[model samples]
Target: MAVQENLLLGAKASKNATLTLVFLSILKGVVGFYSGSASLIADAIHTSLDIFTSLAVWIGLKLSMRGSEEKFPYGYYKADNLVSLFVSIIILFSGVELVREALLNIASPVEIKLQGIALGTAVFSVIAMYALSQYKFKVGKQIDSQALIADALHSYTDVFSSLIVAITIIGSLLGVLWLDSAGVLVISLMIFKLGIGMAKDSILTLMDAWLDKDSIERIRQNVGSIQGVKTVDEIRLRKSGLVVFGEIEIEIEGDASLKRVEMLFEEIEKTVKNEVKNLEHLVVNVKPEKISVMKIAVPVLMQEGLHSKVSRHFSKAPYFIFIELENNDIISWDVSENPAAGLEKKKGLKAAEFLKDQGVNVLIAGEIGEAPFHTLRDNFVKLLQMPEEIEDVEQVVKKVSELNTLTAPTE
Candidate 1:
């Protein structure tokens, strides 16, 4: 959904929660006042605080939807987390107050007025807050709203505290007043722990915690799969409320034209958007990849142009040298009539030296001797074999292109 619509839905949910809490607090307050039960009054106050926190959540969600301005270029996405942290602080204070009140009552031993109405009211509060917490939690998870989640947790603590109040009332009725105080203490500590955890999570988000490893690996795989992308050099992702912001650097072939590079970048962006979820903002930077150029030399016995017939002899007396380049285009052609081509002593070495000196990175020939093979291998030249039946220069080039073992020279 759009940000505005999502925020509107969150506001509606928070408003409904606020109204429910207000009504429940009023009912509990009326019962506590009639019975003069201090525990019941404390629970009522907790519910009223939840109402305020719910309102804070509504305000935060609404404010988070605001667009960026000159003063705040990144928008108000962090407002949601800030409000959540604020609610956690409120919860923490409430826990402390409850603990202090429970300890003082335990120490002084005030007789709690335990009545059927008080117990019934406590039960009702527990059930109501439990239902409200469920609703809030479900909606918060659906929209991925952190403030709503914090508010939901705050409401959840209310349900537990109400349960403790019920126990306190039951213990007072059974003349075991200390159990009520003990339950309150336990409930307060639980709330304190939950509040601290929620606050820590909010602070981490506000500080821009790094994304998980799985997400980084997924980005690398998706971007690396794009055509012309050599590698995904770097990936950085950070969470902002429900959205994710990312920066990536990818490498492509250096010889690509500006138009081709632009198209590749577009493809990378589209692919990432399609594969990743909740990516609100993405910055992709492209770098050119370095690659080594291959220069292939083929000995040809021809009577015509570049596509002429191939020669089967490696140390032939007179041969036409066809140099192939990266795109299978010929760079040059020369008639190599080396006198060492007819020599028996070190003829293969001499021919290999001649080809190497011509700056040939790869040699395509038919039936090269062992001596020339070692020479080519030592000189870091790749060799592909051509059969005698392959008469055309094009056929020799095709054979070399199809060769899989470019690391080792072939006879």
Candidate 2:
């Protein structure tokens, strides 16, 4: 339901319960006064307190419906839980009072008349409270309103207490005077139990407990299914009122462009929103996976490690072929004599085939003819043009790292 409609429904329900309880409280109070029944008076007090409880429920629902602000970016969804917590405390206090009164009555029995008026009032209350409880329970469940549910449960307890009151008064008139206090004591204990349960639920919500495992798994599966996503690194979700808030981190290919990554993020958002319902806020963090190093081969004249110069004459015999393994920086380097160096016949073809067999990812060179270039191209080797004058292996490696090219012009 829309926010405004939900708020209106909550207001209507609260108003109905408040008015109904008010009328019943007055009726019970008058009947209790005339009949002089202690149990009726106690029940009247309980009904009267429910008026305030229903009011709390309405206020909580209204507050919870408010939109997020600068100070409260997550909105007021926890207001309902806070109110429920307070209502539980109130119910607990009421139970303590009932227990004290029951003990006192049991210790010093007060002779009081149990008239037909008291019995009629108890029966009337039982029927009225039960009907109201059922209505509130249905509405509360429909809206997923915790405050409303708490109030409904509180009212339902009244139904039981009313029945107990009737039974106790009847038993007292039948000469078992202790039954009156005993029944009140039992009702008080039940109220305490209900209050403890409601408080536990409210506290769990207020603490931002994670949603069920199944719901989190569903979210993970949906987001992880998007194209270009390498993995779902992490996902966390918590319920706030009827809405869910989540944070997700995903890994994607390291080579994905900025635009491609952005598009993947958008897809993740759409996929999750479509699959998961009632998500209020979602924060997505994208991390690119690390790229592995490329092994580059440079045909060169080398006397030492750093003093290597590119061989000016391509396809000619070179003193050394430097294979530079690189990631962010050159992690290591290895030198091997060109096996096809100064070959008598088909020198370029032999050299190209030799480099291809070396499993070279890329070949940096000065110049080479069409035949050898085609052979390297067919072999899926990447070619990068480097200055013949460049003598530093580090400089060639840097150029190889910075440049993304294949089939450089023969210079």
Candidate 3:
């Protein structure tokens, strides 16, 4: 779904939650006021505060949808985090207020009038708030709305608060007047814990903390496996309010043309976004691989050290020598027999795949068929030919080193 639509849905969900809290608060307040139950009154007040927090969520979701990229390049994603912090503060203060009222009542020893209505009202509020909190949590996580989640946490605390009211009312019925006062204290501590946790999460999100390690590693593996990506240099991502923002630096395919590079960039972006959830914006940097030491492959008819004669048929070659040269100096050489020599069909394709796996950048062959020519060229393997007089592998290396655009291959 579009971000605007998602935000609109979030706003709708929060609005509904706010309306529900208003009703629940009213129900609890009327019951607590007549019964003189301080615990019930405190639960009612917490529900009232949830109403305001839910309104904050609605406003924050609306603000997050307003895009001002020209004025604020990062947009208004932080609006949700700000709302989360605000809701947490309200919750914290509510907890403190509840605790104060509870301790004061304990010191003065106020009498609580127990009735069937008080217990029934608290039980009803508990069920209602539980259902509402679950709804908010599901929607919040579905859309990844921080403000909505914070509000959901706030509402969830209401379930516990109402349960405390039920317990206190039962204690009052059992002739323990002081039990109602102590119940509110437990409710206060639970609310305090939840508020602190929520506040810490909101602050970290506002600070643009680094994304989880698993996500980073997933992006690295995905981008690295692309056909045109040589290396994944760096991946940096951080969670904004509802989305993730990041940049990835990668080395482009070997000797890729401009058009090819563009395709690689698109592939990398598509792959990373598909792999990572909520990744809305990504910057891809494609750098060309610097050619320092390049490996060249030569087809030979014999296993002789460096004097193996060039094979007329590429796929039928008995041995292939891989020569690594840096700045035109032979650094190392290894010879391996061509395993595709026995393939009667698709021999050229098999040989090309083998050389490609062997890290051959350029193929020095005497005669290359049409199939292998396109296959090798598509893989960024340079196709070059030796003169008719060059029959040995040593001469082949010398000719390849001096070969340039002047003596390029011809069909």
Candidate 4:
């Protein structure tokens, strides 16, 4: 739906710019011939090139939107780059032609009978071209169309050339005849530089250059924040007309089940697409990391060091002691108050979340409930059950150390 709207608005903007250029071209030609303003006639010729450029932009918008997955898998988006190249060539030729005419006029200075009609026409062209440029620029930004933006810039050059014509008319009346030709020379050089820049950008886009730095960085930050993502491995993006296509690679723990992996993939995709406004599609690749250390969380009734007795219930515990493990040995342990303790309802789910946020890889709970069991499993936190008979923290840790003694939760 959004793509359709962009195409519609883009077509309208480019089409309107083309029609305006045609009107300005005719208006300048008739006025310049009768008034004997050589610079105005040269500007008229430049306006003609603008007509071609605007027309090409309109055509490009139409062709670029003809993307089909079955027919042309990569789409016809490259047509926009082709159109941009064509616009660049037209600008270069027009500038060269105008520059040559300016030099000839300077060599053999011509007398101008500057009439009010000629001056009025030049000023009017300035107003019209400026308005057209603004319109095209706004629409181009909204639709994210590079070709339309280039057309807007072409219209801006028209504004500069028209202003030059007005200045030339004033100079002719002031008897500074050389100023008219000099103004045309300045206008030509300005447009020539613009054409070179546009051509360079078009060539680079054709070569599949990476997206700009700011956009890539924003995507990276957003994707790296997903809960299960251990690392953001790669992000590759390219623009096709107004849309962006991308591939992203991320890392998570090795123990994540298939369902958990799928969930992480979905979240990563959502984050990336939301960060970039023009993203069309993304492929997420998930890799697993070989974890060396894991944490075990046990709900304790007292805050006593190591000897804290186990709580009677999962969420009703007063504190949680996280045991850090490397291989089968205990490396260290620390305890923190359970934020969800003493809750009348939904305690199991909230307590499960608290443990997950603490990076608990394995949980030691003798009286685990059903709701919290599923929650921990979904977060890839392993469940281990020790005998409720041995209640001391040190004794529970010793029992869980022998992997075979601990019973895991099951469906």
Most lDDT-accurate candidate = 3
Put the candidates in TM-score order, highest first: 3, 4, 2, 1
Clashes of each: 0, 0, 0, 0
Model 4 clashing residue pairs (backbone): none
lDDT of 1 by residue, 284-327 (tens): 78776642556676666654655777766777735646454656
Q: Model 3 over residues 24-52: C-alpha lDDT tens digits?
A: 99988998999899998999999999999
Cα lDDT over the full model 3:
0.84
Provide the lDDT at 181 for model 1: 64
Regions of model 2 farther than 4 Å from truth = 110-114, 225-230, 252-277, 289-411
TM-score against truth, every candidate: 0.67, 0.68, 0.71, 0.70
Worst 10 residues of 1 by lDDT: 402-411
How many Å off is the CA of 321 in candidate 2?
Answer: 11
Predictions: Cα RMSD each:
12.8, 10.0, 10.9, 11.2
lDDT of each: 0.78, 0.78, 0.84, 0.82
Q: Candidate 4, residues 38-136: lDDT per residue as tens digits? A: 889998998888888888888888887786788789777767778888898888999999888988889877767646788899999999999999999
Error of 3 at 131 (Å): 0.8
How does candidate 3 fare on TM-score? 0.71
